[model samples]
Target: MSQETEPEPSPGPKQENGPTTTGSFLCLHTSPPLHIALHGMSALTHTRLSRTAFDLCLELLEAGVKPQALADIVVHILEFKEQFN
Candidate 1:
């Protein structure tokens, strides 16, 4: 997938696997294209999990994951989360 170069995120607490509710997820409040630009292919996956690909990508971008690397990271996050669940 195409990569977007971004910066690293500041250290903070990590998240856990959980179900998503409309009130719990992020970016859903924003315009669809903006959401798509940020989350890409992982949009639905993150939404279903009560997670936010946009939020994840922002954090990943801050962590130097780069925009282009987001899709891959989302894929990895999803796979990893699914592996144990």
Candidate 2:
């Protein structure tokens, strides 16, 4: 069954690190979500994927849903986001 999620604490959409087309920024804030997601990506790829993946990872982390495995689910979610949209 589908469930509605609680709202996120992050800032609104207008505060993007870059333009929507560019999709992300170069500055590293050292947030937990970014720390994990940026683990293996190259500089170029990280800047590109960070926009979408960072938000998703932040949402998951805020929900108190820690995974016992490694970065597996994070990778899967990234792939899904890329594949579907």
Candidate 3:
């Protein structure tokens, strides 16, 4: 008699490091400019602001923002925001 094979484990849902959908939506409406500014500053400053942005992004992600959407919004805001220009 042949031995029975075991079933493979199913994969779990994917998890993101930052910005949940709800958080991103709130962030988009509440302070899109500020969000974009921070993301920009983080890139320019390359130190404190960057870390802060990363932390905030993580918080937003945990709250529910999609990574791609959050990144797009951040880039859009950063490009147009006067301070960065």
Per-prediction TM-score, please? 0.32, 0.29, 0.37
lDDT of 3 by residue, 2-78 (tens): 99999998888987644435633544434557567866776786543345668677567657778789788777766
Candidate 3 pairs with clashing backbones: 18-61, 19-60, 19-61, 19-65, 20-60, 20-61, 20-64, 20-65, 21-64, 21-65
> Candidates' lDDT values, in order?
0.55, 0.53, 0.64
Q: What's the candidate order when arranged by decreasing lDDT?
A: 3, 1, 2
Clashes of each: 13, 0, 10
Per-prediction RMSD in angstroms? 18.4, 17.0, 10.4
- Candidate 1's residue-wise lDDT over 1-85, tens digit each? 9999888988888664343233323323335564556465556444444345456554455455555577676668878988999
Ranking by TM-score: 3, 1, 2
After superposing candidate 3 on the true structure, give the runs of residues whose Cα lies further than 4 Å from its correct spot: 1-49, 82-84
Give candidate 1's whole-model lDDT. 0.55
Instruction: Identify the runs in model 1 with alpha carbons over 4 angstroms from their true place.
Output: 1-53, 58-65
